[model samples]
Target: MSQDLYELSATELSASYAAGLDPREVAESVLARIADREPVLNAFYVHEPEQVRRDAEASAKRWASGTQLSAFDGVPATVKENIPRSGIPVPSGTALANPPVSAENAPVTDRLLEAGLVLLGSTTMPDWGMLSSGVSSRHGITRNALDPSLTTGGSSAGAGAAAAAGYGPLHVGTDIGGSIRLPGTWAGLVTLKPSAGLVPLHAPYMGRAAGPLTRTAADAAALMSVIARPDIRDYSTRPYPSMDWFKGPANPAGLRVGLQLDAGSGAEVDPQIAAAVQRAADLFAAAGAHIVELRPFMSQAQLAGIDAFWRTRSWADYSALEPEQRENVLPYIARWCAGGKDYDGVATMVHYNRFAQVQQETIAATRDYDLVLSPVAPMAAFPAEQPMPVDDPDLPMAHISFTMPYNMSGQPAATVNCGFMLDGRTIGLQLAGPVGADDKVLAAAVWFESVRGDAALDWARVL
Candidate 1:
């Protein structure tokens, strides 16, 4: 029964109640799975089994009374640590002692809870979400579900790990750069970084968006429909009308796609990763979609500008911490924060201006195409507990070359598991669309997933 419960997706689990399976029984199976796996994967930072059981019992009662809230009622889901959930500590992946618990739920959390999705716990992330690798000073490191020696990627580290390890079928993670995609790519899952303002963000910053990491693009679309609903709290929330994201596009029979194999910069992509992306493009071409090779739209200077913006923003957060608390942060994160201390207002503004120009160029370059395709990262997951894959300590941006450009442009982008490397690491093919074309982007992903079949799904279940 536990094995059968573990195999069910969130959508399937929700429907199981109608098939005579109690939500409480399913919840117990999930808790038991976590108890067996959490010690090795380190996927969750804090989970209250008692609280989860109580919520499950309530959901079962609702089911018995024919008062379920949504299709996801009684489904298990995990939230990233940085997002606030009432009564859970928002550690933000830091080692600070007795971090204050959240007094209220973040907008995303509220939506999930209101839908009756059971909160499993908060997942781990790098300190202040500063690094792409899974290592963190607060919770040590999150190991890849496929291989214990490899990283799960970050700052959505544990969310990816939890999803890959079969803790649940739905998980939420935030992406400022490649946080969600990086982990999704490494963990052989599908993740979407919805366009800016699609998901209500409190005190939003440039390039930051909250989204889902799941086993299938269809599941991501389902979660997005609920979370992207209008919230009055986020002043920046777009007034866009809601659509049936779960249905995606009816088909991708006549879409135009632009493909870029390399960034035209010094960063090199692994052959396996590039091949996987090409295979995805080929699949689209076979589906009657027009595919054109595109030149790099972003320059080295533009990339540097984006990096500077993030560094400056991170520094501001780090510098605001109490001196002793600052010392508790990961050394790499601290160093990154310190690197921005010397920048004057003028220099920072110059970077912002450059970033704006880059964003415009990116939009204009891909405007003719319905979608853009590329590798999610330059390579697969690297060694666990490391900051990056490169031997050079100075080139921290090497692995992020492919995904960060979309973040700067505020476009909707998603990464789907396309294939795997010889060393057992997964490769992700990225699908991106212009700002506010999130549905189109996800539709293309779903179409590709249909063609790709369930190879990645089978791999994920290897646990």
Candidate 2:
């Protein structure tokens, strides 16, 4: 029973454990999976076999006494490297000063532990959670579980891989750019990027928020309820009535939706990806969502200029690093920095103002829609071995074209498999809602996940 449940997702495992599988044995089975998969995936950097057993044994005892911590108490999960666990060293793959760990548990981790989740270890993240792709010089590249030849979206690459590989019941990841969503989308898993500041980001990196990448959307919602508790660490965390959230698995009905078709730059969305987007839209329409296709806040000219402006910001963060700081820095990062020294503050402000105007206009447009949908990336996951996409310059900010603006706007966004591409990779379609409507956005994604079932991605067969 434990072995069977180990292959299940946190949601499925929970359902099984509740049905009488030994919780302790179930934890050990998951640990076996982790040991079996870790070598190639490189998903975990530090995990002690002994501590894992202790936690699992404790959970088993709780179960025997009818004292389960929560539905997740005995489940195994991984935290992103940047999410400090009391004594863990956080070398975000770069050196400015080694960003130290928090003396106490991060609010998100604390909640997971309180709910009885077994923290397997920390997953790899790009240096300071920077960049779009998972390739890093610091802690070697964390490859896509579906295809080691393909890239995993970063900086939450390890979390994505672990979920895809079934290393644990759930994978805890953080997203500022498309971190959780991109990797999950690419890996054929479920992801949730909470509305900004909803998950407290303490210590190592202060700005980004944390969330989960799982095999099911319900797990994301469940994790949300646990971590969304008020914390003095994050001053901007939302105070919504979350007690009733995740209480049910209701499907979205009659929800209002908007679709952004022409992603501004006129970069042709791949044929397969477009079809997946339409498929998702059809699902929404059938479910009674009033679907409206509209162009919002992006135009050909505006996006081309934005393509250049956003790339420049990457330099500010990476350029701060000393040569010694980035021994593992990917080569393309240097190529991007080649001409950045010439950019002036005026050029930067021009980009900032344009972003401001577009987002302001977009907020007005979103007023009528409960959700806005688009493709997660202009292209599907590309080969991992290549340092730069041949279309490098064409990639706005060098490969992440569609996911950044929302991060800039602090909206709650997510990516899930829309369908499979002609070449055999998954196409991730993105959907977003205004800053605080996370649960509603996830509800729609959950409905789509059910409809798209097998179309959801995982690389078990390919890997």
Candidate 3:
């Protein structure tokens, strides 16, 4: 192959395997890429190259005998460290606790292994997966693959960096409040946060989900096809349905798309990001889709309520740890979690109840449109050392206003790179749909990709 194997998409790898391409060679290419980029990016918490080689060799033999486990057999992939895989200790981005090796695979890990995708290893995250930035106690800072000075947004931090740096085609990331999409924006990739519970998870929360972060929408679709299978472990998920993820909407014609420029309250949207999203909307309008401007659906009260509740939640976890263990947590995360200690039961309940209001408002606001478009985050990439765009523990969630609402609403949202900054940083456009509309959201992303064309940043030129 003229192009390096490390750069092949999951779709391309599947075809190559079917045509007798050795999985071992692909693994070697991936390993080579990791060797070149991992030192600079710090993208992986646990990467065992020998294990990758062994897995690939097994896959190569399976391909030789035409006994491959699935269509994507032997494709390289990585899982976020937060996701449990048997025998892998899930540090969860904090050194505060000594976690045991998992006895069983999480639904996402099980599905990927069962599908014959070679597990490249686990990526890193921030403390307890709380922060939306890459500054972590356990893994340090995971820099953006596009620019080392900037962050690879988190808590799916390493997964984003790995995907952007060509660390293979498939990466599994968990998102509750823009973890996947924010990083994807910074890295210029396709990130899908499937409707809550659409993808089975072991410890299902109200809005937490596991989805793919990949270079292309097609690869994200390929991953979803495998991981979206229903598992009895997660009771929160909807019944699995058959869907053709590869095919997108034929065109944008006749679709009513809502353009949401304001996030209600938080950091103001950057001018460049705003312009990029407007340009994206114009493109859709040109294709005959009816574009409607949307008013802000969120408010500072709602943002504060969720923030208070989450802080309390984090404190509950921190309080359970030993005193020494608590000290090991990152200072920013520790201070953030400490804020929860001041809340009384009534205050806690009041804050927690805000999610319902957020859900109601989000659904009501977008119910009229087939899809909504907004900037994934308020700003482009920021310094890797900071925990969030605002860089304040008290205002930790100020940047998530746009992405957080959908999680509360249980809507399906995706981040597809729509444009780039003059300096080459990516601007992600969030495409979201109503609850249970995962298929529609992904289909729209695929359609957008068709017209968005190639990204300006060169993947091969990563520092």
Scored by lDDT, the top model is 3
- Displacement of residue 221 (Cα, Å) in model 2 is 1.4
TM-score of 3: 0.98
Against the true structure, what is each candidate's TM-score? 0.95, 0.88, 0.98
lDDT by residue (1-463, candidate 3, tens digit) is: 8999999999999999999899999999999999998998999999999999999999999999989999999999999998998888988998755677888899999999999999999999999899888888877889988889999999899999999999999999999888899998888989999987789998999889999999988899889988998898999978746767877554789999999999889999999999999998988899999999999999999899899899999999889888888888999988998889999999999999999999999999999999999999989998898888888787648889999998889888999898888888899999998877777788888888878765434566764
- Comparing candidate 1 with candidate 3, which one achieves the higher TM-score? 3
- Those runs of model 2 whose alpha carbons end farther than 4 Å from true positions after fitting are 95-102, 203-207, 247-253, 299-323, 326-328, 337-339, 387-395, 398-401, 457-463
- The candidate, 1 or 3, that scores higher on lDDT is 3
Q: Worst ten-residue run, lDDT, model 2?
A: 386-395
Candidate 3 residue pairs in backbone clash: none
lDDT of 2 by residue, 1-463 (tens): 3345566767776776677767677767778877777777787767787898899888888877889999877888888887778877787654345666657777778888999988888888665565555666666777787888787777788888788877775777877556777786677777777776777767423225688787777777777777777778777666655534464443557777888766655457777888888888888788777888867465554554554554566567667777775454555665554445566889766765766665566667677887888888766786665433343633445334456556656677877778898778888778888878788777767778778766765434733
Q: Which residue ranges in model 3 land beyond 4 Å of their true spot?
A: 453-457
Name the better of 2 and 3 by lDDT.
3
Q: What tens digits encode model 1's per-residue C-alpha lDDT throughout 230-285?
A: 78888878877665686654366688889999885547888988888898888888
Flag the better candidate by TM-score, 1 or 2.
1
Error of 1 at 22 (Å): 0.9
